[model samples]
Target: MEKERNITSMIAAGLLALAAVVGAPERALAADGAALLAANCLSCHSAQGGSISRVEGQRKTPEGWQMTITRMQEQHGAKVSAEDKRRLIKYLADTRGLAPAETAGWRYLLEHDNNRVETIDGRYRDMCARCHSGARFALQRRSEDEWKLLMHTHIGLNPTLEFHSLARDRQWFPLAVNEVAPALARDFALDARAWKAWQAAPRTALDGSWRIAGFLPGKGAFEGRMRASAAGEDRYELAIEGRYADGALLSGRGVATVYTGYEWRGSVDIDGVALRQVMAADARGERMHGRQHFADSRRMGGALSALREGAAPMVMAVMPAQLRRGETAELTVVGSGLAGAVSLGKGVRVLEVVSRSPDRVVVRARAEGRDGLNDVAVGSARGKGLLAVYGRVARVEVEPANAIARVGGPGDAQMQKVGVAYRAIGWAAGRDGKAGTADDLRLGYLPARWSIEAADEEAEKAHDADFVGHIGADGVFVPGDAGPNPARPKSLGNTGRVNVVATVEAAGATVEGRGKLDVAVPDFVQRALD
Candidate 1:
């Protein structure tokens, strides 16, 4: 409990740091946003666009700008008073906020604990996410040239980056400049019209009482009430009270600072536990949705939602969002005004409706042989909750197509072991005997057998056979030692790329899904808060 408290305190301190800093803005000469930036940033950063500076060409979220400003303050001794810093952050973020359309499909990546596997092309994940959280890249907007420049800076500063196992295995620099940079620019580029329209749009007001519901993994589902009142400009204080599915009472209070006029960042204490909240309000402010994570353990937590008092029936949550295809399971659907027939939508066969109430329902269901997101329905009202269907293992997909395992050495600095999981999904070949089409059924993850082997003769020569770690029966990857071995390539460091295979017998035939592994230096392994 003491340890938990300490973790909570650390989390609160980090999140509340900005709140506290901006709350007591120091007295300074009244100046507009541009003046504040000129005084604080224009010294080293050029105000206008040029070939030499990154600031003019780059666009970022408020959190991204905050990170950059904090780094500038700590590393380069950029001088700015608290007031000046606050103004500077606002100036930069307002001028550089992501266009709403640009953020449409990807906001969850920024505002919540999103576990839905992002289908990033294999090469980019190996090249980028291995070093930093994928959010680091997803949160920024840049031109092709800017993206290329960033890669050049990376290779220039960390020459080791190119020689790492992944880089050496592929044509890293050429692919990055030619394919990756262009892709990122095309996908995440700045749009002046979108930005201008968003700026001109009215912002939502998030004050007053609201009904709330959410899920806490392991602890189970919950329903609650929330009251939000003004704290400052674009900021609000939240008081939350709720009950878990097990009838355990829960409560919390926190102050939220809004960003992009929608993103909500809050530090709160729930039932003596510390947690940080990341949520987004819609344009109407009718609902605010996101997640909360335990302070100490980043991975622990659940989804959260808030609706205006007496709002229309909203399906707030559905537990076990994903169900195995062709397997029967009991699911709990939670929401307000859950009445009449509860539909699991299309692609799901409801065996029986076990029970129904205004706020909760239990039913037996078997998801059909389809792989995709399906919505849950109660009576005539639609829900925020989703039900996904994944069929049995017709094929196995080993995740992290490119994965890195580190030689976790002894003691505190030892790199952590990496785990690779195999997903067994059912896919059916369509009329042309080809796999890409609406007719292809997706069966989600299933039980499978896992193993590792050297991919080729070169891998064998590198002693990848010796370097490869043992995969558990449950498909966890355990690494070997951080070697200075004479058996491996000396200049390339002690690392090897192995092949991970997941096998399962389905439809009377053995099917397999393959993925690659990188056993490399500890430095490249990404840890939380890094």
Candidate 2:
């Protein structure tokens, strides 16, 4: 009987893998979006018209497409390479991006990287924003029926989603279908006329030189210039040259693909390390702003911007993005025409101007312990810079507030463990009650030790660790076997809730924060629609 159960588990596991693959991204690895979809995906998601009929007339941001691709891979089992995924995302975003007129008021949120919390209204706030960022909802256009289908997909896949702490107090599904879906469709509905006009609009000719300014944390600030020549329609060959804060000359070059009419995606090498660029050109195509990060370690990067030749002075970046309170340090500021004495903003006092030039400036400064993240300004500058002055972390917050993990079944290699990301959100208490408010100081990302344990004594008595497996310092929670465990009453299967904790040391004190994690048997395949 044990052997038979093992064989059955293996079959179930295989089926789950197949299901996930079916939902994954396409596998054609082609640059032609239509051709790629027709060759690989049309076998299942048939194309009735010129495009994949199901996705016809829909528009979303690059991130939304990425989420769609991820769901496809996780739930349906689509297989595609990373490069192919990028190409596909670029294609989709370009073909289905929000029109400029469609995104008028919201573009500010995209160009700026502020930590301000986004506000959403009504049942949608309780039902949707709790799971995804408000930006996700803001950057898409869909018809009413399409929106309804999305709601159905959520309900069908994660039935207990509404029961999660964030939504447990409300009638989630009913409210979502009756109110939320209609509201979203009404507010963000597809502007077919606008999309058509944008498609026919004159494309930006990104051929020539542009001044570039940007910051890379830990590396300081850099001011550079980039020259682009047309490679093809909506594509360009890029060459870059710059100097760091310490007067080190830097050079690199690569190719870029423009999407959504203005969005720019580039693959380049910086000082021999692979880097990816995600920036968007302004409506006039003269100014571009966004960010770039190393392909390997995404955390090690910063903001970037470029301006057309002869344009006004634009500040690109400030190196070492933030300052530690009560500490003195040298700051490198990078931008165009950045002459004259620099201002270090509030909570920071400039001790001396070590050096100054058109593109770079180094200043000796100290930060006051009480100040939070502050914007640094240059006297009569065209663009603003940023800095953070923070002291020891007063508290840590576990993002998402809750998470889920799953146990692997016997003979199912893929189900061995579910990885969970435990990020430490450090906070210095503010005069206001909230940690994210203007007065409260945010310490940003901080290092931490991670662990998991039963949420209650009953779970402890059951020896839940024997079944729930363990979590690693990297924040991944691996679960035990799927079958009933011999550790508890009738071995209540390998399922339960546990606490995920993060411990950090600040100001010679230990700070600990926790989030709830649910461990359960693999439910990769939806049994039935809710």
Candidate 3:
């Protein structure tokens, strides 16, 4: 029993020692977290109400603390590392879990942390720094709605940010306006009084000359005469001249109302382009802050900040027209900001141009030439055999004539024409040397006259009867008297002469003779011989 009691005491002491060791770390961790919070977060936040008194009772979840730390790094230039961020979040979540009373303040600070501004100028700088300067923002006195619309318009045109990003940024915008606009309004109120004094005191001073030098975000710069007016405080008018990049000379007249401290609101019409803008000087009055709006389809409005500088006069001119061939006509080119010149075509030529104004010119092109043919060759010109005008030509027409021949007896002859239309006669031949065979059978043009002779091939050769003849209108040959009968007659002795054979061919068809002929000698010849 004594041994067992001793063992139990040792076990209890061991358990107590382990508990002390584990408890020591928790205490150390809490102490370490307190130290970190004192070193970093206390500067901007406090347990009691102070600079950021709204968040004094606020508690945050671990995630909320992480998000807050990231916002600080982005907006306020805080440099907390990943490990430190984790530790900081753990400490905040353990020490001050979210409480109902602190919810509104905590949410407001977290949402608006990026927009918090310690100074009026800082607010202006943050709001307009992306596209313009603080000076440009300061020159405008638009209401909150107008400011929101301007920002929305810019966000629409800029594709870099998404809708969600714009929505997030827009939530913080009101906070910025609240911080900076009050200061601007106070400054403008004082400027109005000074402007009134300047206008009342101004007299006997020559107006300053303003000559246009160039343009800025929202307004044009010029150097010419600026005359003070007695109608209102710091009221003035200016006549300025300058040149555009295209060599066109521009002249403008403007009226301005000055607010004290070098701030001015004005509208001007240069050439035909109208512009409105606001300008203000910094506290030191060394530079101007302004916003300009141009009368264009885009209705572009932006900020402008520049130092005062001397101006000079220059001139610019309109560019000539650039013409190019397009299909069957010429293309007339007109640039966005420039006027277009006149052009002419094949049947048209520019006669004259009447100029009513620099921007408005009337051009006249008269038709002077015949309609041009579709196909034109540079060195040589040819046309279709058939008549055609400005259109495609058709195939050539052909009417080939048929072939014809004649056949007849010794003293009389007949003719006939045959075979295919739109065709020519080719070759013709005859046979010889047998009783029933053809001889002296020369083929020729059916002559104006025809006569039959002996069937001797030699005789036909001597007569040279193979000549070409054209088909007559009646489609027949009218054989005249035979050219002096052949010297020898064809003899058949007792059988007497039987018949004369003739053949005709045309294209691919042939016609042959098949009739007989008979001759009777007079008895007077026999009596004369007796």
> Candidate 1 on 460-500: residue-level lDDT in tens?
77768566567766566667666566655664455677888
Per-model TM against the reference: 0.61, 0.55, 0.21
lDDT of each: 0.67, 0.69, 0.35
Find the candidate with the highest lDDT and give its number: 2
> Candidate 2: lDDT of 141?
90
Segments in model 3 whose C-alpha atoms lie over 4 Å from true places: 1-207, 216-232, 281-291, 295-530
Displacement of the residue 500 alpha carbon in candidate 3, Å: 99
Q: What's the lDDT for residue 438 in model 2?
A: 65
How well is each residue in 1-530 modelled by candidate 2, as lDDT tens digits? 64344444444543454455553432221224644444445444644433465577578877667777777776788886786677668778877777776766554344333223566775566778787656667778988878888888888988888779777887877777888888888888886677778878877766678888766544545778888888764678999998875678889989987778787778888789787777778767888878776654343356678887655665556665567777888887766677666777777889988888776678899988465566666655544436667766667887535766666657765444443445676777786655556666666656678877788897788767656778666554567777777666886887887888889876678998888777777745522210
Q: What is candidate 2's TM-score against the reference?
A: 0.55
Model 3 lDDT per residue over 1-530, tens place:
54344444444444554455665764455555555554455445443321123222333433455656776777677877776775666666544433222222232122111111223355455455543433334333334444445455555656443333323556444543464445544532322433334434422211243212233322222222223343333456756554433334667777764433244456777667776645544443334445545533112333333332222111111111111112122212111111333433344444565442222223433443432211211111111111111111111111111111222223421212111111111112222222223322222121011123333454344432222112233222222222233342442111112213233332234443422222222223222322
Top candidate (TM-score): 1
- Candidate 1, residue 477: Cα displacement in angstroms equals 4.5
